[model samples]
Target: MSNLPPQHASEGLSLADQVAHELREDIIGGRLLSGMALVEADLVNRYNASRNTVREALHQLGREGLATYVRNKGVMVRRLGVAEVRDLFLVRRTLEIQAILGSKPLREYQSDRMLDAIEAAELARDREDWQAFGTHSLRFHQHIVGLLRSPLLDAFFTNIAAQMRLVFAVAPDEENFQRPWLERDHEIHDLLAAGHRQAAAEGMNRYLDDSEHALLDLLSHPTRA
Candidate 1:
């Protein structure tokens, strides 16, 4: 692979840190799919980094549960199983529902962030850019969890989103799989914005149930996807 332009390192981030952050975003953004080999040599060339930097980046992904070391295969994207999917959904429900129903007052900036994600997803869908649509859709939920104002939960959910996108990679039809959630996200946002917390919570519950069921079904029957 030809070497690409150097990463624009964030302030205070080392080259290795920048490489790892970019790789993490690729996973969360659906550019890297589950079970795909993360070849060190190619990555070193692609990111314009040394072998050590590339190895460190891959190790970061491994620590984040997004990559793994295979004896002969080196490192590859971690292939998730059904049990992890179920457990992820459980955590999704717990955190998202509390964010909606908890006594903490809703913040305007948080609401605007969610709206921005929804509008971005809508734009992506309009352009038939399903991959970008999926990223924004995931961001919508991440912002929902952000409403709680806890940095720890926000960070945890970022990892969850990355892992969840790996599962999303297996969907046979991206448009068909992701279109409904866009509408549901909008509806829930509307309810919450109008101060209808109970209704929003109910809509969120339904959304989570439907989403978890669909994903579990897809994982259980890969042939269907």
Candidate 2:
């Protein structure tokens, strides 16, 4: 399969929406790095769309808080700061743990998604693809949010995931940065799958706490991180 995201192929989306959606996916997928310039000319060529369409697309991203306009610098992927990391985790804990705690007794399909993410991470680890491992780990949490069955929160979490990836990228030691939590992802999934949701919720809270602390530490010292 091609590594490129689909361009202008989905039904019912307008030209500008096509570009915005693709860029949004690129951001969440980490193909577009935080603070990377979103040049109008380059985007026009890349998406095979008009310059106006690209501008509109970028406007949409800016509205979504995934990108921002800077003085003399034009638009770029939004660079999250230390404070944003803290707030992101606060939301993560709220939505993620609540999903686990709120979903009474749990269900196979929900747990299945978490299990699939775990297996994907293991595959990435076996291949020594640390970046893919990080992506899969995020997928695990995305599945956790899925247990809530709220489309609105699911959509909001997509933007949060993009910001979260930017925070993770700040840590140069990516393997050591993400490895500890990979185990936790598996552990929580096991607890949820086995219907031990209270245990799973507790583990999730601690996991987010530790994860947030580590991220803030990384942001504070990116060079050494």
Candidate 3:
């Protein structure tokens, strides 16, 4: 993986936010494996941040569902069990389906952004940049949710998508897992562009269903990295 850009105090972000952003990227990029311990002392040493900053960053990750604070275990990158995986996908399916079915007609700008996101993902895939591919893939879906123009829903989906990355990090054959979805993403976008709202919603439903099964299958019979 490439080196993370250095965080500067002059950047206007809080120290905690900077720390959290770096650690979050590590988790999503699979640099920090699931269930790996996140020790405050270790983090402080690594980031050269204060203990309070590390603590706050860890709390932020907890809120994003990227980490969990166990009673005596402190913080660890969350490892979702089979049931939790299914439950997360269940809520994801519901939210995405609602967004697709109830969203306003696609504004031209929204369409353009969606297409850009897909194209970016394709480019990333061509370069075997799985991290960028995953990032843009989420952005593509985020643009679909953006159709609702609801800030609350956008924030909610963003949080869920972060958790989804945990699952993506653990899946075997990450390239194969992400490849098929590129076509489905294109099909969904095409349906929306054609003004076939119901068809697009149905297409999203199928896409989510297939994704849920694939992830669940991986959880059931995981391949160790």
Best by TM-score: 2
Rank order by TM-score, top first? 2, 1, 3
CA RMSD for every model? Answer: 2.8, 2.4, 3.7
TM-score of each predicted structure versus truth: 0.89, 0.91, 0.82
* Model 1: per-residue Cα lDDT over 118-215, one tens digit each: 99999999999888999999999999888888988987898899999998876888888899999899998988888888888899999988988898
Alpha carbon deviation, residue 153, candidate 2 (Å): 1.4
Model 2 deviation from the true structure expressed as Cα RMSD, one decimal place: 2.4
Residue pairs in steric clash, candidate 2? none
* lDDT of every model, 2 decimals: 0.86, 0.83, 0.81
lDDT of 2 by residue, 1-225 (tens): 122345445455688887887787776677888879999998878877889998999998898778999999999988889878888998999999999998866677877788888998899888887778888899889988988898889878887887787777788988888778788998998898788989999999999989888888878888875
The local lDDT score (0 to 100) that residue 45 gets in candidate 1 is 82
Q: Pick by lDDT: which candidate is best?
A: 1
Better of 2 and 3 by lDDT: 2
Better of 1 and 2 by TM-score: 2
Off-target runs (Cα >4 Å) in candidate 2 are 1-11
Model 3 ranges with Cα > 4 A deviation:
1-22, 25-32, 45-49, 70-74
